[model samples]
Target: MSPKKLFARSAAMIALTTASFSTFAEEVNIYSFRQAFLIEPIMEKFTEQTGIKVNILFANKGLIERVKREGELSPADVVLTTDISRLVSLTSQDLTQPIQSEKLNSNIPSQYRDPENQWFALTTRVRNIYSSSERIGPVDITYQDLAKPEFKGKICTRSGKHPYNVSLVASVIAHEGEANAKVWLESVKANLARKPQGNDRAQVKAVKDGLCDYALGNNYYLGKMLADPKQVSWAEAVNINFPNQNTTGSHVNVSGVVLTKYAPNKANAIKLIEFLSDDVAQQMYAEVNYEYPVKVSVQPSKLVASWGQFKADTLPLAEIAKQHQAAVKLLDEVKFDL
Candidate 1:
């Protein structure tokens, strides 16, 4: 035990200890299709409250395979996606775990969550019509009215295969019956002001360009357009309408999250999801994304509130996921090119 040998041993011990301490630091890994900036505040809040660092991999594509490839080695504790169909796909593939959070169960409405707790809807958005403020005067329009001959060649929408469109069409099927919904879809297809092409915001732009008098858009798109300083003119050109309020109300969709089946940090993941379901986080979700908080007690953003309240189709959103294949087939039959 000479001085040089003792010094070497001490250094080796210190290195090993540092590595061990680093491994022990609390962390939760999340794979989210939602943009990093959009969910940063929530992530920060979770970290601040629980002192657990969240490592997020944010990508819109290839995340599913990445998770599958990672398999038992996957570090992802939770996944956040925008639609029920996508959530269902993940669960069907056995990539997600059933989360049993009482807070989530109590806060989220049954209509907004999976029956088996495989996923939970965090926020909701309605698929409603956006009309040109100057060209279209104040008038009520129903999803049914979109098929009217008077509106032919005056409507715009995104591609039919899109989950939003699929779910929207599914709601029609649930409400109007398949045969009637198919007939309505065909009629609406004939009315396309322009070939289905672009995201919801683009539909608004088309309306601005006078390519069409009206467009189908989700409520959040209107919120994003209105919030964008550069898109102020685009915002000015259109007015929001919650269709069929006096009848069946407007179509709605959700942003939901699920725990990974092999989550290494189940406790932390449960805490994170529960935190998101609570009032403060729910309010942040509504204000930041301009979406309706799933929590009934949480009010919509001021901009959303201004649009006024409307009934939303209560078809178990799981049905939208279940009927997604049928919706896609119908969209194809109707020839919605996007």
Candidate 2:
């Protein structure tokens, strides 16, 4: 089916063919946490290069639960999700199985792929600090700096429990240990311009609206906001800062994929995974999603490169994943979002 036609059917159109059942021989079913718009062009390119058909079911939640419920009957040949924590959760749930592909191993960095090969990060994004161009001027900062008395009532962030913040917090725990991370979390909360209350873009808008001087956000959202007519001013109002360049490097996250535990179209799924890991598709993933490709050979988009590249935190994401619960509890303990 054409990309337009595939999109027209949407999630309602995905056929639930079990491993024991059959739908289309050359087709693969994707259970994606990512929106269809982001993947359609890449899927189109995949189809153009290979005769394989891609069917998608896009969901914001419950994909893992659904897969588990379906057991071997699940039609999901692949699962694509954002955030290492979600990938870790899926692996812990046993919804995914390992894929030992040389192409995947060669293309994706070891730090971004599961040690067990259950999931591979397709692209990366940095958690960044957006400084007001007018008020802040040039700035040098770190994740730890957000806690200082100088920044009190000057920082804007979303809920501390949100995955992005949690991941950063988890990294702090990984680096500083639980006790120091607790103190840091409290200090960060003490610095909030207002109660933690919105998404990453909202933090940027807070900077624009003069509600705050420093906002915590993702680097790619700068690209997204710049491209959005309504959000362009927000992007313009702040200078994107890749934090911790002088320290341990900025925290990085990924949008990744996994082969399902019982992928009916295993061959096609592997082909899809390999396609995404290569330069062409990695480029597509970077440009389309405003993210950094996990493949070392693929360059980030011009807009992203304009943000000034820095060393991504080399801490294995798995280590951060392990501290997620501790980070979330720290958020609750600090009442960071309250």
lDDT of each: 0.83, 0.87
Superposition error at 32 for model 2 (Å): 0.7
Who wins the lDDT comparison?
2
How many residue-pair clashes does candidate 1 contain? 0
| Global local distance difference test of model 1 | 0.83
Cα lDDT of model 2 by residue, 5-122, tens digit: 4443343234444222234788988888988888888999999999888888788898888888777667678999999889988999988989989999999889899988988999
Which residue window of length 10 is worst by lDDT in model 1? 16-25
lDDT, candidate 2, residue 54?
A: 88
The C-alpha TM-scores of every prediction are: 0.91, 0.93
Structure candidate 2, residue pairs in collision:
none
What value does the lDDT take at residue 84 in candidate 1?
Answer: 79
Error of 1 at 332 (Å): 1.7
